[model samples]
Target: MAEQLRLVVPLHGEQVSNMQQLVSVMLVDDEIMALNNLKNLIDWEEAGYTIVASETNPRNALESFHKYRPQIVLVDIMMPVMNGLELSREIFALNIPVRILILTSYKDFLYAKEAVEIGISNYLVKHEINEESLILELGKLKYEIQNTETNDRYLRQRLIRHLIGGLLPPENLEIGIKNKYLDFKIGSLAFLFAKIDTSYPILKEISVVAKSHSNFIWDIFNLANDTEYMDAIRLNPDEAVFVIYFKEEELKETVREIASKTCKKMQERFQQDYEHTISIVPIIVDNKNQNIRNIYSIAENSFNYSVYMGKNIIIDYESIPTAVNSSFKEVSVILNELESDFVKRDSESLKNRLNIIFTLLGKPPWNPEDVQNTCDRLVFTLVKFRNKNSIQDNPSKIEISNLFNLNSIRKWFESEFISSVENAVTIDALRYSRIVRKILVILHHEYNVDLSIEEIADRIHLSAVYIRKRFKNEIGITILGYLTKIRMEKAIELLSTGEYKVFEVAELVGYSSSQYFSKVFKKYSGLRPLDYTSGV
Candidate 1:
């Protein structure tokens, strides 16, 4: 068979420890059996390294080495066409930082000396080679590589922070550019900010998820480094920002397209692999005056629009309107209408009025803080309405600050605040009428037994006609209608226990006929008793 080379990489969603950044490795041996032995010597991935490629021919190994640029290379001393020492010399002459290990059966000191002269990292006699010795050598090399990477990363992050804070002097920036740390050119630039849309149970800490997100984005942009230089940094526990530097000023539209595609890819991969939804905002820096601090500020401000535009979306900075519309007078008028609707106990009108408020606040030119304050005021009004009516149900414990967007806020108001207020209003209407109260008590207590308006009126010492009219007027339902509601609710509770059959539940909830109960259950719950039980 011809010389073979194979490449491998980490599979997607593989769990890797935070301390283990994978180091790439290549193996070159003339003997196919020796190559197989070396590959099986250790679990490369478990040891914090990956066997990216293996070649059986020295010449082919050299070509693959140049193509892959692996950080570490393991080669046999005896090879056809070119010896391992000659290949090491060629690799060293290329001026790349690569560690080379020599494997051979010869224990001659002169060969070892020659290998050392060629800058080989270690020389292992094939007879003495085992997993322990090989791992010891690879461990040292991995430590050195990690130290170098850590230092470079710290320096790069410091420089980026200084640049964004407007603290980097011109001279220092020039030095950074010269050292290839910045790699910026005279051209257009953009800032892309990404934030997680929801907190997942698996990722407990925001900082851990943010760091992973940053690393993932860095890998993607680094792959596209041929067209632009991208620098990514984690801004906080929940957000990461990227600075994109273009080589040509005329590539303005290209910058937008590239940024959009990069963000789209990040969104897709994170969602697919981790079940996360991230929102990204890309802000193109003003070419006439490229102030790093101002550009970053604009990018952050633009991210707030995710509340209205929604999660897993891309919002361009230019698309946001800058005009300030801080008029609270209109908001006060709407609040007054909302209070009126609440006091009148008109649930539909109250919901419509609340929706109108969200619509007006959700529009552009309004500060998010102002919108939050307006929502707080609406909550306060509802709370006051509940207290005035003496409704004892506590307001929902949802924190307004934790609600990130207008949609979530609207849901909180409807499910937590408005629903409680409507229930309180219904109770207030029923509390003043003794006849209605007595009728309700009888219906709730005697729901299992056969009940009638005349029977309830006789127990309460009132006329059947007066009791029916009063209960209907106070509760907005006829006496028979209310009894049926209570009986149906009790039937559902009993059926949910799975301890009673349809005929048995009919007797337990005041329905003498199972067929009549089934007909009534279908009308109330849109399912026959048997169908509902099957689902349960």
Candidate 2:
């Protein structure tokens, strides 16, 4: 014999009545008088129906749907705003397993059959319902639905717990988990959090691409390449977390490689404009362990560690050693060398110093923070140099105030680093170098023209003196000297090709006087421009 399910009664009592425990129901009718009459005449609470919400206004049905999300909807066939049948159809589209009971007074069997086709649970004629009959009908519906108060209550509590768990403050995470009204079993898991350092515009592009398909969850999981238990969830608008379950014996280095590759792929695929950090916490917890109060704290600390150590790093809780001092020492050494080069105004030495730092770090060629800091310091130094020295005292000179504001170096560094971090290993250093390279290219390209150093600086959004110093530090030549060399070279090329007269060539290279152009060209090349070009 099969086990019979227990039922509860509906009555004015503290405990649920016998018939009430078996089912939950909702009631809806367009006629206010009729709806209230039914509510007063029938003891619905006794019939195992939980009237979550009763609305005389059908317009509020959608709001009720969001609020209650009930298992059953008793609706009138005709109503205003949202008609009963139309509302029923729309509600069914939500894919909720709702048992809808339709009430109608007209003798329309055809309409009743249509309701059945539309998945209505039952059709009742309004005139046929009396106080006793209603009780009997509701009791039958209760038994049919087989609602369980205990199970329903537990599920609701679990959903609430899940949502609250993710949103809790860092300090309150574990406390929130512990105070959950529902019971859940947790297992040992590995957690990682990440922040994509991108501008709002770039982030929006990523967002659009991320939602282009339903396979995002699966795609990210596959990207992790973890065959073991894997779960991923978006923690916030700009961050995500991946939870992985693996035995301690698993190769941990492989996890770091996977994470780095994933970050690279995201950058390449989305053309991301900034560096991002993937913080890792590889931990082991039993299935029954539910404490997560300090989860965010641990994760946040790990995140800051990653940022401090530089981005794109994977730090495992299981692998940290006692020799943290050695790591700090190496970083300090690099910083000291960079600071020394900046103070000395040694352009070639600074470049060589940065190269050494990159080699020591064993990161990619594109990585090194030295060059970035050097660019910043060089810019500032030039601005100070110009403020103290008058350029008119030496016409063959450049002025810092004419070009860029050295004080805005921080903002400039941020924009450059955040815009092309993907192609860089040492993101900060690469950004500074790249910007310096761009300025040099522009200067060289327009060397023979009547170019204003300040204009070029303004074009690239840097100060003239700062640009000159930074260019000298990176390219091993002062900006004016380089430009002079380029114009002299062009003058020689024109003379050699016999493209124009000596006077014309002189004017072409930005000198109004041919004698002056010849004097400058000979001084730079150790020969007269015409003689160097003639070679006879």
Q: Considering every candidate listed, which one attains the maximal lDDT?
A: 1
Candidate 1: what lDDT?
0.70
Q: Candidate 2, residues 258-348: lDDT per residue as tens digits? A: 4444444543433332222223444433343455435655555454333224434455644432223233235345544443333233345
Q: lDDT per model, in order?
A: 0.70, 0.52
In model 2, which runs have C-alpha deviations exceeding 4 angstroms? 1-183, 189-192, 197-234, 242-284, 287-293, 304-317, 320-323, 326-340, 356-536
| Candidate 1 similarity to native, TM-score | 0.48
Q: After the best TM-score superposition of candidate 2, give how far the Cα of residue 178 lies from its true spot, in angstroms.
A: 6.3
TM-score on alpha carbons, each prediction: 0.48, 0.28
Give the per-residue lDDT of model 1 (tens digit) for 1-536: 01211211123445434223568899999999999999998988888888878998887887777766688999998998999999999888765568998989879899899988778888989989889988999999888876765554556656766767777544644464435444434356667787777421111232223335545544433332222135567666566776665544345676677668777866777678655577888887546356667777877787766666666888777867654767565666676556545644557777887788888887667566566567667766666767766767564565433455776677667665567656764775567476676676567556678877788889999899998788878889998887788778667756765667999989877888999999999999999988888894
Candidate 1: residue pairs that collide: none
